[model samples]
Target: MKRRDFFKKGTTAALAAGVVPIIASSCATSKAIIDDRKKDKWYHLGTGKKAIPERKITKDFEVAVIGGGAAGICAAVASARNGSKTVLVQDRPVLGGNASSEMRVHLNGVNSIKGKAERETGIIEELLLHNRFENEQESYPVFDHVMYDFVIREPNLTLMMNTQAVEAIMDGNKIKSAKCWQATTETLFTIRASIFIDCSGDGLLGASAGAEYRTGREGKAEFNETYAPDEPDGWQMGATLLMSSKDMGRPMQYSPPSYAIKYTHEDAHPRRSFKWFQDGIWWIEVGSKGDIIADAEVNRHKLMGYLHGVWDYIKNSGNFPEAENLALDWVGSLPSRRESRRFIGDYIVSEKDMTEHKHFNDAVAYGGWSLDEHNPGGIENISEPPSYFHYHFKKIYEFPFRSLYSKNVSNLMFAGRNVSQTHIALSSSRIMATCALMGQAVGTAATICNKKGVLPRDVAKNYILELQEQLIRDDAFIPNRPANDANDLTKSASLIFCSTTTSGDAKNLLNGISRDIDGNINHWQSDGLNAEVQLEWETAVEISTVELKCDTNVKRNIMMRKDSKNDELYGNHVPIEMLKSLSVHGRVNGKWQDLGTIEANRTRLIKFNFKPSKVTAVKLKLKDTYGAKNIKLFEVRCYA
Candidate 1:
């Protein structure tokens, strides 16, 4: 018998013992099987074919990021922005991972209060800003090509699509290079880098390169999580393929293949299964309750069949009238796995860490999403009560940076759903928004490591303060704001400072005001003037330095007069120094005429003597040199 036939016949006994028959026998050709088994039996055979042609090695990079998902893209962008030569490797043609246009899963996170925006920064925020500009009137599924283009356009980033990292070339404890296989031309190539990031989600690099990792849940005592079961188990949350349907005037009929499994009322809460829609169609989710990696194909077929059956029920069973005209729109090609291999880093984030709201010396990321765990199997509907489901916790929590790097591996950093966390902790951090933050943190850390000529672990220990400052500068929210620590009395005061435009159309205040042709300083003098000012108070305290920030490039000075029983412009015009490219400062009383440079892309701070005796009411004169623009002032302080 032929090799393919021998394997097919070999599976007969397993089938006789109740294992599902292999569908590849009919669809897979001998040549395909031989090609797929070229490496090891551990590789997964799937629907996608790689498209990039392999090339010979000609360059080296500071950082290499595997998997073009949200985490990987952010990591690459952050590393590159920090002046590192970065390369991103992705197997798929586009970026965004599970939240990509191909997958179409809506991104979710902790919703900020009304009128308040979540503090998301770095590449993720830039992407959102791009989305905002591209789709001004409405929200759209962020196009995957846009994501790919964003990375490609960056001067320091090189994106390698249709490339799969097959093996890690290790030198002692560090990864020296990676061997990648391009499916399009059946070619292999090698990539050499100083640092490697495993954003592959499945911990593929870590596992292949002998990094320590965990696969299943730990006992409750291990993590001290109340939601965790008392005893440890081998069971893990499964993977799912999301599908949807569109209205087409009449319900489309679909029939399952002969080999497809059928569902019965006794199959555990089949009644809860129903159709809903988003983006373009009414939808339903179907998944594999067993091994995600092992049963990917089986789950794909079953999910398709389940989707069709759902439409069939709507059309023939008269259960859903609103969906009678629904037609199949799209089905996910890649399975979204909830749990798989997790790299064991220096610090494994446990449920106890989350519950206690542990503040780490090297905290890099935060997750507020609940601890949601799904059941292993035996039920088709995820909403079913006992086995397959989701659970939640009361509040949000923080995750440390040490959990992102491997304990055994020297220069490797892990991001996304594969970071070092227990099963319960993974549930909350698995969301794409949180994962993007993890990527940003790792990318920032990678840049610091490269600059300091150190490992990721070393960066975490020695340069953690620098890392935190960089993250804060990039707008990633650390628990406390640095400005809050500055000594400032008026920091607690809420005052409305106004600016008038000269010649530009002011549509949205957030968009900012222009100095030319819109209006003039006179336009801001009257109540209900063309320009308005609003101040929202955060906190107040005494401080010694004050900084001002503006949205546009301009030379401006803020002349301040104290608001006391007597108000006056104090002495000579306290010449606010044009400290940096965007900021201005001056001592409160000394040199009111001469200004100097401070810092670039940072708030400008000014210091001067304000002896509760010398001044009562101080007046400020506002002037512009580079033209009028909307400005923001912060970090105001008064020394005790």
Candidate 2:
């Protein structure tokens, strides 16, 4: 019988018996099995050939993003949106590093706990929204090709996959160019950019550029992080090759190759293991204490062998007679890495920041995952197995912008799991969702620096606020929203008075139109007036032009003070002369009102007021000229 068919049958039998296979190993194999068909090789899927070598090809870009992971993709999209000619380079054929379809790891984060969509802005969110709309709610194990298509299709983005950055061209403290190798042709290419971002999880660019960095833990007193150990330890979290299993019936004889399993609870310190099920799949996370990159292949083989051995025990051994049908299903292609190199940035996130919930001056992102540290060695001598687990930090913490830039390199920035942070801090912030936000911030900052003809360091010093504003405007959560300062009623009035509500029912409000009684209106309709209500005094106010969003496929009609005897309205209400659709910054002018172009689903509050001396009633009208239903209202407030 085929291995796959055998496993299927085994799974059916196990299920019928109501038994879950418990995998445990007590012996180690001596000889490594070499599988020629399954040998791991880095291939260039784009060009369909091996890497080629050639002379350096130099090209200048506004921003160069290294590493095509989640963070790198977000950064590239941000830079492009900010009008920077951006290039994205990756060592693999796919765009997503760990979360790629090839790798098959789901994007995980705390946002799911809060029932919030991923907190990233710009392209990442765009991709998620697209997937959500297209796939409905069945979009788990995301298609990696969609991610690749999204980045490659961007007009301002240049994507180079299967290209490995080999060296950094530096002049003084700034990186002038990045030297990359084309895997298919084995040719070299030189990419020059005004600003550079390091999204590589291993700090590859930082190391190549001679940037300062640290690996492993510091002494207890070094950063004053309470979790810092008293003695210096070399231990770090290990990597894992996740596998799944199903059940089959009938007894099967299986024997482990020698030296397949090693160590006992006595040999390993802090050895532990556990299991869980999610998304209708059984997951097994093994291997927590070896060098992730160096021992990737070895661990992969060991895991495969161990899984088969566990199946043999379940079928042939009496310990699991009820699990006679259990068998291995699929194993992960890439090792899920937990820790490696951490670059030194302008600011190092210490355990103190996490424990004390320290506020940052240039806060750009947030993280809520616990400080999860895995043991560093295999369970050779231990009586129990080693595992991965989290240590609670009690509160969520903010990550500062300074931690995203290289301390020693002026043009270099970093994001993803490799940002400037201590081992403990990285453990919590390394998740893909937080890294996506970091990528967006870096991309926006790089765009600003390129447009303004400045360095990344200058962005941190001078344009940090601008960068923060851009991120917040795009829906990323910055630590604090700058307070509205001016006291002028007209000038100070904002269409979107308060931030979008994050509570229930309001959760999907981003998907609909909403209005508050105070005249604050957020139009989520496809073909409706995108406007906000601002109150100037209790009743007296001016109706700012109703902004017509450009990207909207349909047209909308706007009428005001329907009951007023002397009411006036402006702009075209007809099909062609109607607002020619609006985008993020597009606006249309009406005789008595001005309409600004707004991105779809953006929060727009229409401002209006009742005259204390005029009448006792006020009315506003919005008619959807095209698509879906009429205007949607979120809240309505009355002022004294």
Candidate 3:
């Protein structure tokens, strides 16, 4: 039987039997054989235990994204949305990488900033808003489902979970195929694609394809980075084991395993806080002076040992009387990694690029997180502080496209911590939201490459402006570059408004500025609640698409969080500035007709696609905002 059919049958059997077959090895097939069931026992009919047969499956796509972390998820979604046939391969059973339930690291983004309009708006914001709407409980496992829904809903994307991409097939300098093993179904996937993105924190796909990369900190002289060591060494950031505990409302005793290590007051530093029993316990880390990728299993075991030791110290140590009723709820088996192999690209971002705010003509993304570098000794270095904050940007800085694609390997790109950067730059750009922006940028560049019949490097050189404009149209904010309105049909039409603006003019809608950049006001704020804006052309024009960019309250936080806090990042509420109900009308024959209507819009970018018609004018009526008192919008666009 074919491997696809075998997976179908296995899924059907799992549904009927109420149990899924556990994958023991990559060589094991999904086929089941039994004998002597009448004796109330089932036994294999084979003479002896044998390896399951290997099933080879070949497929093709325009783009293949490896690793389903925040970067991979955004890359695959953007690629598919941009009309590319895309495939996303993930080694774990669920998506979201460290942010998934298996690891439980909170998704961090521009929220680390104090007061500014630096929020990331594109696909990542869409996913966050969806989680707030669908996942009301704010559960981590449910957040996994939210990510799955986000990818599976895209028609041009194929998602393969529990599949590890092990090998890269090369044709000269370009990657021709990626070979993955799905142990759950005993299938070996040979995926052929035009472009490949390595969002895997380890950069395994790029490394296997002979892509030039760095594994350790570079010397200060290499990139002129002041934060680097005097001499280069193979010491990357350590991996962490996180745990969670809750108040049981009653006293509970804890038991320690035989292998658990012993911890004392002197073992950990006074700055390390274990009193809050939260999920993101980043201190239980181990690995340095060892190959993090090759020695992952060893580091995981060490992290677990240290984690159990810390728990024992909390429950058994006489110093903590407040832990009498607290009980451990969950302890992650997989270690959340901080750093690994970083791919080499045309331009490697350095500490000076962020600190000095270097300008790039090909800038595609922005990041503002502080330089947070953990100690090399991790938990072992108890005498020193856990982390060091080298620097923090006064405002967000631009990330260029040159550092996104590979320098040596053609048709190769990467995102997340594996992107081309000095160790100091990675410290700030490694945040999940920053990685998501890079993913969106690379995914968009891949689509342009597929459509234009060029490589990733060519997209950076020739089609850089097109790529930036497309990203802005999709609601991604570039630090200084405003949205281009040269080809927008609404730019030529005269605006007719039912209600005048109270603060800003209606012409600000087509001014091309979407967000507040460098203290510039770009959006149009109206006085009344049910205001209307219309654009009329001199002659009947054919219109097929209309895009409206609304306000999403980027200054506030809308992420789903487990802890209820007074801060903005932990608030799990929808943005009040978003448009909830609206209607679009078109004048075809001097009479306005209904074009489309949005009932419960939650995203910042609302796009409407309809059959092309000779419409003389298009009108947009705002019925109500999500909860805001008035109507506000950045831009209104029409396309032929």
Candidate 4:
């Protein structure tokens, strides 16, 4: 059954089960009493009913993320990890937006377009790596739980699922609180935060907070974008209803609904590709002529009709005999939207910024997806291609921090597709993985703003270098910017190695680059493992933090999936070269003392912090790797 039909039938049963209070004949209250009671409390009488008991909750956090998609997930995680209390509010029961079980769209990122070298790192990579270790089936629903696990593991993050952020309480130009309503439990949530991130693809939080925004396409002359129309038009990309089919090994009959649209071979002419039918159908789309946000239900209804119509055509049109045993495995109830309101920011990114690779001083994130603009006419345009691809990038282009915060709303910031970018640039930057990078950048910035008692724009203007450095320290990679740890004791202290490999230098550990940078430098290799590296200070130095960046084979794919093709972005297992066992020792009272021991470490970056100790020297002893025969490391740093 469709999700809507199930909800309708379930509501009736829930009412019968006393889930909703009904007026009883024994306690018939007078009209005046009912009106008086209604004045004080919000309730539904004979006119309407509610399922769960109503309640209200008010809480405060450092950051509040108003969506649970890839961008929101990363934003919440990054903020929480950066020493801020964070809350993640998602309307749906699951996370991942279009990549969830409801839609089944693949999670595409920099890897999808730019290749392995530029694959997005940080929270998104950690989640992907976690999914690889925990989920083996590669099922959509399992992926949902994987995302849930990723959020719940963070002690500083609170996950509020099945909660819709319906209203925004504003205090002048800043958002005071986000009013959310939960239909399943009938609970209202008033979340107050110092900073707010609207990763919602629709930019609903920004809209409710009165943030300046733009919708639809821009004129060519406005930004000198060749792909745009000569005159401005209120035509945006349509939302799609994805579907999946599986072979049942037996023929199954399909009956069309009365609302289903009729289709013929001539209707789907040259643009249709229906030969394979196991995954998402990207073309069953609608909603370009109407207000996508206000008329979402209307567009969703049309998309359902188009989806059913296309499925009926595949089954009964006698197009392919192979589809005789094929059955519709699943269909998304909600429309996965593509374009909507894009909040205006300090600087708006244009098509030329992406196409010409324009440089920005505040570039924090990067993307390389080709400019993929779907036709506004959708299924109605039979002769035109489903989407027009204007150009591809030679390398990943940078996205600036200036284009991520509101122009007017002081404490408001956003990521995902709603970030400050023209329609032409958004066409390329709207990919999920690219949005994940932007989310991480903004989330990190939000935490810093909260700690330093400043606004997002102020951080962008004054503390951009600090934000970029923090992101790099947390495993995020920014092109053209090399890592430099000024606090590293190795930069000033003496370095010594017990042994060396044929082509490895112990001094490369202080070079600062973490991962493989264009397959050149910033890494040291020791053959045959069981190597030792030591740093000696002439005078006892106060030290409290130690960081290590190990090699994780960035050139290969580590994403989890059943398909083991080397060419694909996702693979079957973790990288073999990661450090598995290691030990550290520090000189205390003229004797070496064990500081810490790590076994079976999986992440590429690891850090250990302890009470401040005056140590004369520190030593690192490496034992084994997950699979590699040699010990390879990128950089190591000690901060006092």
Output the number of the TM-score-best candidate.
3
Top lDDT prediction, candidate number: 3
Q: List the residue pairs that clash in candidate 3.
A: none
Candidate 4 structure quality by residue, lDDT tens digits, 1-640: 2111111110010112222121212122222111122234444787575443336779999999989999999999999999999999998899999778887766766554545355777788778777766775677788899999999999999999887676678899999998776656766668999999999888767887888998888889999999888777777788889888788988988887776776675744465676445555687776454466755656677777778888898889887677799888888877888888889999999999988888887988888888988767677564466777788776778899999999999999999999999888988999888899899999999999999999999998899999988888888888777777676677777655646664557777776667666556777788778887788888888888878878766655555332334554555566667788988888977999788888877677767687788888888888988788988987788888
User: Between 1 and 2, whose TM-score is larger?
Assistant: 1
Judged by whole-model lDDT over C-alpha atoms, candidate 3 comes out at 0.81
| Clashes, model 4 | 0
Instruction: Give candidate 3 misplaced runs (Cα > 4 Å).
Output: 1-54, 267-270, 496-500
List TM-scores for all candidates, in order. 0.68, 0.67, 0.90, 0.87
Stretches of model 1 off by over 4 angstroms after superposition: 1-55, 112-119, 136-142, 250-261, 264-291, 378-383, 386-395, 481-640
The model with the greater TM-score, 2 or 3, is 3
Q: Relative to the true structure, how large is the alpha-carbon lDDT of every model?
A: 0.56, 0.55, 0.81, 0.78
Local error of candidate 2 at residue 304 (angstroms): 4.2
> With candidate 2 superimposed using the best TM-score fit, by how many Å does residue 630's alpha carbon deviate from the native?
12
Q: Write the per-residue lDDT of candidate 2 for residues 1-640, one digit (tens) a residue.
A: 2111111101111111101111111111111111122334547889897653333467888899998888999999888878999999988777777667445555554432232222333455455544433443232244456677778888999998877665677899998888776655444678998888988787666677887777666667888766666755555555555544455465444465563342222332343432222111112233322244444445555554444444454445565455555555554555666677778888899877876778887898877666765434432212333433446644457899999998888888999887888877877788786788899999999988877888877888888778876675454655434312122222322233312222223212232222111223333322335432222234343332222121111112111111111212211222222222232211112123322332233222323332322212222233332343333333232322
